[model samples]
Target: MALSLLTPNSLTKIPLTKLRFVPSLSPPPPPPPRAASVSFRRLSIMSSSNGIKVGAAQMTSTNDLDANFNTCSRLVQEAAAEGVKLLCFPETFSFVGMKAGESLQIAEPLDGPTMRRYCSLARDSNIWLSLGGFQEKGPDDAHLYNTHVLVDNYGNIKNIYRKIHLFDVDVPGNMTYKESDFTTAGTDIVAEDSPIGRLGLTVCYDLRFPELYQQLRFQHNAQILLVPSAFTKVTGEAHWEILLRARAIETQCYVIAAAQAGKHNEKRESYGDSLIIDPWGKILARLPDRLSTGIAIADIDLSIVDAVRTRMPISEHKRLESCQKISSLSSL
Candidate 1:
């Protein structure tokens, strides 16, 4: 029996009786008095109703797919060990710095090998996971999409959001990313019911578009916004934290951003600074540059979304009356 490729199902079939079964039968301790299992009614009353702990994982990955998977697995395990209900990883975590047309070679079917691996990890750790920008093979194999997927503790995929806004910028002296050259943009916005709360999903460059977040927060009632980014060091230094905090303050939603930080492929440098921000625009936990792989755990109190909105009443203040003038002018 080869131990390397054995699965749980395969291991279960081998009879234990066929193998040596050593038993310590020295008068098994007198059966302890049976204890009644607590009813669901009692358990619900004792659990906290308002808060859930979530984690953001920062991964520094290279072109090696196996190494990247292993690193992500370890970080997820660390987060699960710390009792985090959900964990998120940075963008393009599986393969970074691959040339223009090279991603196609690595792209997998939505239910293919990569997802199976992720599903297994999610079930084993019993933690919800969101990995940024998996290379997903499109319909008919015409194009590949940079897709973000959410998996529940049961290893079931809850939602998939392809990168709605591709990175088509060409910055002088810094970086030039023309994602549109290889990938097609996704049209739909994805918001899903998660264990923590309603979650709105976005990838790296999509963070720049405020309208997306606005629609997600106001229309969809998203409580948490997940941004898995691989921002360049130049832009990240300038706008990463500020933009993340601004989104939290504007939407009144907890922002969990896991970013890639440091140099990769002997050329490109990513701005790390993975952060977890509260609805009040306060930084709860942050992983600074060069931290590599780690978890940023934060208590996400969904109540804060209401509390801040109630105190400020901004959402209500944007009444039809205020927008009427703008609408009337546009109509004319």
Candidate 2:
């Protein structure tokens, strides 16, 4: 099935029936206000201070750089026209499955054609953009890194986050991916200030680590977390939605994830349930699997975070005694 782009009006009315919620390990308190106000520089109507509209685009990219870029351009335009202030594209948005050694050949510099195209699109559409992982050329002609690039509406590069946790796992009887063989691991965690709110950036494999999201929300005060992924079909089907919802409910932040879907190259397939979860862990919007392209939109209310946190106050409940016991045992 081909993916569909949902408008704000249509998306707002989507019944919560389609939404799925994880049973929070701890029961959350009652919800706070249903809406809150927000403002954005480029998005005038969105400035009503009520809510911020964010979007996710699911894409299937191949070895052809030009074709993938064109598809992304169209989807960004469509989301922008629908009044999306922030949009996220799937991981490996530029080039997907080529030969193992071929990624270096397709890798581009940060300011090269691929980024330039995205910058132009951000400026033209006046939307904050986060394109999923791109193949970045490293030191020599042989090394590369899976990098996520962020661009503001003015077309300036806001930040770049290299995938910190590389996918180097071997799935039983299926596939083995050795990302470290070709890509360099990132050294730093990235969080940026934006017009909408504070944003935390992470790539696919980072989702498995809950500590990262905790630091992003509590330490950095991130209002929205961006996860761009190209999860394998086996892992994604088993853990994608559950892990995403768990992060949202635990952190009380909006979770926006863009994913690569459908079959790629000869035998590789990506799990395609691209989604946007609210602070309450409600699945606001989602795209079906096995599609070339699809878009999901949602209104993210910053006030909900405060309401949920205030009601539960779990983040503040700490047992220094228990922590001390664990630390003392480690010393032995």
Clashing residue pairs, backbone N/CA/C < 3 A, model 1: none
Shift of residue 174 alpha carbon in model 1, Å: 1.3
What's model 1's lDDT at 82? 71
lDDT of 2 by residue, 117-218 (tens): 889989999999998798889867667878989899999999988888889999776689989888988877888998767888999999999988888887
Candidate 1: how many backbone clashes? 0
The numbered model that scores best in lDDT is: 2
Please list the residue runs of candidate 2 whose C-alpha ends up more than 4 Å from where it truly belongs after superposition: 1-49, 288-292, 320-322, 329-332
> By summed lDDT, which 10 consecutive residues of candidate 1 come out lowest?
38-47
Estimate the TM-score of every prediction. 0.81, 0.82
Tens-place lDDT per residue, model 1, 1-332, is 31111234331121111121112112112323322421110000001234577877776677778888888888777777777899888898888854656677788887999889998999999999998889898654557899999999999998899999988888767977888777878999999998798999999888899999999998898989999999997898678888998898889888989888666666777877677777767666654323446776666766666666776677777676668988999999
